[model samples]
Target: MSRKLAKEISWLLVTIALLTMFSPHTADALTITTTRKLVVLDPGHGGKDTGISSTTGILEKRIVLKLARMTSKLLSDQYRSLLTRTTDTDLSETDRATFANQNKADLFLSLHLHAGKNKGFFFYFDTPDNTPATNETTWKTQGLIHRDKNRQTAELFAKNSQTRNKKVKTHFAPAPVISLEGLQMTAILTEPFTITDIPGTAAEQDAFLAPYAKTLARCIETYFENKF
Candidate 1:
């Protein structure tokens, strides 16, 4: 073999050896390429549970479902938005929490429509039970680790949704009161507006839901920004 060809072969062998010594598949080389957060949107009440009733015949279940869909669409580009129910169906609170936990959602937002003479936003966070024992087997027994994170997210939603013209209220309750038990992630429930107390025609409810959905999307974005 020619000396030049032999030298080239030696160089190639050295390069291959170096690459084998410094492979990119090492644990330290691994990184998270996707930063998009996973958000679960649960539209409360469905089927037999019509929730609140409006004078114009708008049902709370239908309105909340619409808002959840729109909010999911708005956050599609920034986050992985998943809805617990896509249609009119009854889902138990346990089932809802299990869905969120199974999907490993980063946050849970239960969308609701209030049935009262008030027009305000109410954000509710989970008040979990006793802390789980520090054992691998009991990790899923309680949500104490996530309580602070849940409260922070819920507070951010309230702050972001509140404006000079609109005020957002917050409520703290146990898991039974808000149906947020069994969740392993940050959880929040939002009652954006009331259908029973709309100031305009029934058709105007759509318009109301539009901006409310946008506000929710914005709040979610803000929450993640501060979180990371």
Candidate 2:
């Protein structure tokens, strides 16, 4: 063989060996390319913030926490779910959004309950700022930028709720609340139902929440599907 041909063959062999050495790293990158979406669920009120309490011994903080837990469990199969507070603890609205932003969540949901005889859901999303973004747009107003996505998610949940319970009233509107303020990711505040009319024992409340949690989880799954 010619010396020139032998030199070319030697260079090709070296290139192949180098690629083989780096192939493991390439495989690792590919494996992590499509990560599961992370969702941050904030159960409203805790600790001294008992929220609404009834003479019957039920508390709003405890009610929402259980809903958050059930929702998180339902989402476990296809996504990463986290709660701002696991146990009864103090967690401010700002702190909840900060937790979601720090974790780079794809979506943030602030769950809540209210005291009313009406059985209905209220979905609130921040109004979109048509004003161009500026230096003033800090985390304090970060939610303004994601207002469109927030509204979309809110509508989705509202539609899903109606589908699950056609008789139940559900509304989605651009009324930003303290619980949904200062979020860097798409966020929604939902008072899924009023506790005043939940009826029956705590165990019956759990039964009511189970199907509702499934609805929440299904909507989240549909969101990620559309996102990707």
Strongest candidate by TM-score: 2
TM-score of each: 0.72, 0.80
Give the candidate number with the greatest lDDT. Answer: 2
Give residue 110's error in model 1 in angstroms.
0.2
What's model 2's lDDT at 97?
A: 82
Backbone clashes in each candidate structure, one number apiece?
Answer: 0, 0
Q: Which runs of model 1 end up more than 4 angstroms from their true locations?
A: 1-35, 117-141, 164-178, 198-203
